[model samples]
Target: MNLKGKNVLVTGSEGFIGSHLTEKLVEIGAKVTALVQYNSFNSWGWIDTFDKNIKENINIVTGDVREYDSVKRIVKGQDVVFHLAALIAIPYSYLSPMAYVKTNVQGTTNVLEACREYDVEKIIHTSTSETYGTALYVPIDEKHPLQGQSPYSASKIAADKMAESYYRSFNLPIATIRPFNTYGPRQSARAVIPTIISQVLAGKREIKLGSLSPTRDFNYVKDTAEAFIKIAESDKTIGEVINAGSNSEISIGDLAHKIIRIIGEDVKIICDKERIRPEKSEVNRLWADNTKIKQLTEWTPKYSLEEGLTETVDWIKNNMEYFKTDIYNV
Candidate 1:
């Protein structure tokens, strides 16, 4: 499926990864309709950072994914629908589990129903590594048993199953692209990579973080975006859940130190209890087995961890004003 002349709808285009994916689709000559959450201020989240030329090519639609009619309307006349919209913060999910259920689970339902109704050629549903609670085993594959340790993960698990059910019962042409911890420019402070870079660049002597022992398989945002395109282009990915990751693991403690060293900062690491998830709720480790995606789509991570982190640090340095470094974002 060549994307050059196709019409694509990307929900959550106002977000970090969604914005990047929307930009890439536009670059490939796809007519993209960016679905952003509506606000009275009319701000288009990270899409605002895109260049004027790219922004002009995209059609921005403001609506809530949890609303059935709104999702159905935006999904009409599109060849493919990439659903990336969801409530992603783990800490915030603990406070409002019902909101996660509405956005992540019910919102996904709306997208699937729209695709089923519209008979869209392809639907790429976004999944997260957090669904595989902690690494019961290293290099976790799609077959790994899901354990929702947090409210956020639970909601995502529900959403993922819903996507699967649609494929089985309704024969919806859906593929779930489960990405490991993706980080790059335009990332919010809720993510560890951005948090470390923002604090370090902001000249904080003591870097505050939570759960230094937890490990993750980090992939660059560009790599993840490219993987999504590849999955959409491949016929073999229908009704499948593929992973996008670099099969590399790094602990939060080591990652923080690496960021500090890269920025040439002499900072002390301090564990912030307020920033930590509850003991049982925290995922201790996650490492992806990306063999399925490699077999199905010719997708491999192009950026090494060091290379990605360097680029992220440079981006944070230039865009420090966009972030409130002193505040714990969410």
Candidate 2:
């Protein structure tokens, strides 16, 4: 599954990770059609920030993944489909569970149907570490029993199962690419890394956060993007679920201090009750078992947590003017 000279379609191409993956595909000489969620303003999300060289090579398409006709139309004539469009915010999902079902579940169904119909060579369906809920054991692997502690995770679990059914029933050549806590530039404030950096850059001496006890396995965006390519290139990944992670773990309290240190700030961390999830819903810890992805594809995380956080802090510092740091972004 050589990507060079191939036609690729990346849904959610305007998102933090999707935009980077689009650029990487373009760099690999793949003709990429990027599907950005349509808006009245016609904004391309973070892709608008891409340099001319990267943007010119990509065929940008405006459409919603939840729309079957739109998804089918954009998926036509594509060799590989990277379906990443979904509602990702956990807080938003709690407020509107139906929206998550519509986008994450139904939207994924649309992409799978398109692939089955169009005879696309392969499809990489994006999954999240959230599906596994709080770690029941150390270094969670693909075999971990899924327990959806939030509406967002529940929807993703449904989406992942839907994709698996397609592979079993229709023999759709799809691989589920599950990534753990990917963070980097262009990340929204909904994510902890960006939230911490944005608040710190805003010159706040005190920062508000949710629970700090939970641990996460974070991966830099570039490493996750590269892992996607490696999975797509591997014949062994068909009908498989593979993880992309740094195989390292950190507690939120420790992670916040790490960011504070990187920003060179004397900040006080305050736990916001409103920001916290219900005790039953909170995922207490996550540690990725990267053995499957390592065995299936030659992919390794290139950036350490410190290195990635440094780059992320620099990005947030330079882009501080673009965000409304005073308001909590849900």
Candidate 3:
């Protein structure tokens, strides 16, 4: 399962975590094919931020994951398929649940079917901690019951179940890597980390946010990407749902204050109702038990929250134009 010479296809290569994973795979000598969502601009999203040398090493494919034909065409001849594409904004999911279904659930089905048909060596299915919803128990593990508190979470739950069924019914060599709230460089403003960083860097005196009371286990993006590679290379991870996290928790309120303190900014915290999820849809707490991944693969989070946040702030400060701090991004 060594990735040194493996042919790897990453479905969401244009995204936040996906772009980072694609770069890591290329660094380790994997033949990487990055499947970017098709757009007339031919944009590669965050992958465009990579240096010329690294960008030149990747084979970029543009197609819609919702279409089986397009997915099958790209999946052919690949040794491992890393399915990371999905519509992840929880608020947007309430307005367009069907889109989430098509991209998340149906998109996963397309990858699974293609892998089964092509006899790919292995499949690494990306998952989110949102599938577990609010923590009924602390330090949620793979065995925790899933609660779909939002349409977005529900779509991911469906997608995760699909991956499990593929492993059971078709015997596809698939491993589900469920990562907690991953944050760091290149993260979209739709996420809290970027939102806070963007506003503070934009010289705003007040930071707007939603549900500061809700807590999450945040993992650095690089660590999360490494976990994907580790899981794909481990024989023990096949047919398993593993977690990638720091096994730590932080509330949005405290997290925001920390960022403000880090930036040495005098800013007021404003709770924006429009940015908030429905009362019941908001996940009150999420803390990961990363023991399974630690046991299965030589994977551990290397970045501390403070270190990761410093890097993220620096990135956002340099890329401030890419984000619009005035409006809430769903």
Report lDDT per candidate.
0.95, 0.93, 0.94
Candidate 3 has what TM-score? 0.99
lDDT of 2 by residue, 102-175 (tens): 99999999999999999999999999999999999989999999999999999999999999999999999999
Clashes by residue pair, model 3: none
Q: Count the backbone clashes (under 3 Å) in each candidate.
A: 0, 0, 0
Off by over 4 Å in 3: none
Candidate 1 accuracy as lDDT: 0.95
> Candidate 3 lDDT, tens digit per residue, 1-330?
899989999999999999999999999999999999999998999888899999999999999999999999999999999999999988899999999999999999999999999999999999899999899998999999999999899999999999999999989999999999999988889999999989988989988999899999998899999999999999999999998989999999999999998888899999998988888888999999999999999799999999999889988888898899998888
* Pairs with steric clashes in candidate 1: none
**Which candidate tops lDDT?**
1
Q: Give me the displacement of residue 100 in model 3, in angstroms.
A: 0.5
- How high a TM-score does candidate 2 get? 0.99
lDDT tens string, model 1, 1-330?
898889999999999999999999999999999999999999999898789999999999999999999999999999999999999999999899999999999999999999999999999999999999988998999999999999999999999999999999999999999999999999998889999999888888998899899999999999999999999999999999998999889999999999899999899999999999888999999999999999999799999999999999999999998878889988
Please give the lDDT score at residue 213 for candidate 1.
Answer: 96
